[model samples]
Target: MKQLYYAALIYLVLGLAGGLGYREITKANGFTGDTQLAVVHTHLLVLGMLVFLVVLLLEKTFTLTDSRLFPWFFWVYNAGVVWTAAFLAINGTRTVAGEPTGAALAGMAGFGHILLTAGLVLFFVCLRSRLSTSDTAPTTTIGR
Candidate 1:
């Protein structure tokens, strides 16, 4: 749970930084055209920060860490988000600098998407396994 909190915090900071970096870099370079840099900021915020925060809540409710695949999901998902965002940032920077874009960046970014997909699958599988085995139904203790 704490680990999830920290991950969310880290991604929140990274996302904010990515956005600021994009703004400053583009402004400095007089770049007015669309670039992959903006996507990097969004991805870090949505997939990185928001997803982790939601996962933290799910963990509190479902104890997802108890699953064998939870650790794998955690690491792989984070790696994918970072990998994709990094390449996007690099491509954006290159675009802003008026440099030629190439196939290698696209390939690397594609792999990151694959990793994110696999991690999402793992999360669902873990959640399903837990729900299937849970004998206790959800009960309200709000008034108690």
Candidate 2:
């Protein structure tokens, strides 16, 4: 839970800072030709900050840290979000600068999506186990 809180806080700061940085970069460069760089802020906010915060809340509700797969999910999801956001920022800057993009960046972004999918699947599996009706009511309080 603490790890999740820390991750959420870190991503929140990064998302806010990245949004401001990207806005300034676009303004300074007069980059209105492409919307690629514009996506960096959205991804940082949604995937980095929002997702982690939601997960932290879920952890509190579900006591998700008890699951063995949770640590894997946490790390993998964060890695995917970070990897995707980094490439988005890089590609967005390159596009704004009128630079040509290569295949490597695309490949990395695809890999990030793969990691995100795998992590999500694992998270669902862990959630399913916890949601079984056989579990004690005291431990699995839904509205508490």
- Residue pairs clashing in model 1 are none
- Cα-based lDDT for every prediction: 0.91, 0.78
lDDT, residue 104, candidate 1: 90
User: Least accurate stretch of 10 residues (summed lDDT) in model 2?
Assistant: 131-140
Name the top lDDT candidate: 1
The local lDDT score (0 to 100) that residue 36 gets in candidate 1 is 97
The residue-level lDDT of candidate 1 at 15 comes to: 94
Per-residue lDDT value at 95 in model 1 = 91
Q: What is the model-wide C-alpha lDDT for candidate 1?
A: 0.91
- Encode model 1's per-residue lDDT on 79-141: one tens digit a residue: 999999999999889999999989998898899999999999999998887776564766678
Q: Pick by TM-score: which candidate is best?
A: 1
| Poorest stretch of ten by lDDT in candidate 1 | 130-139
Q: Once superposed on the true structure, which residue ranges of model 2 sit more than 4 Å away at CA?
A: 133-144
Clashing pairs counted in every model: 0, 0
| Cα lDDT, model 2, residue 104 | 87
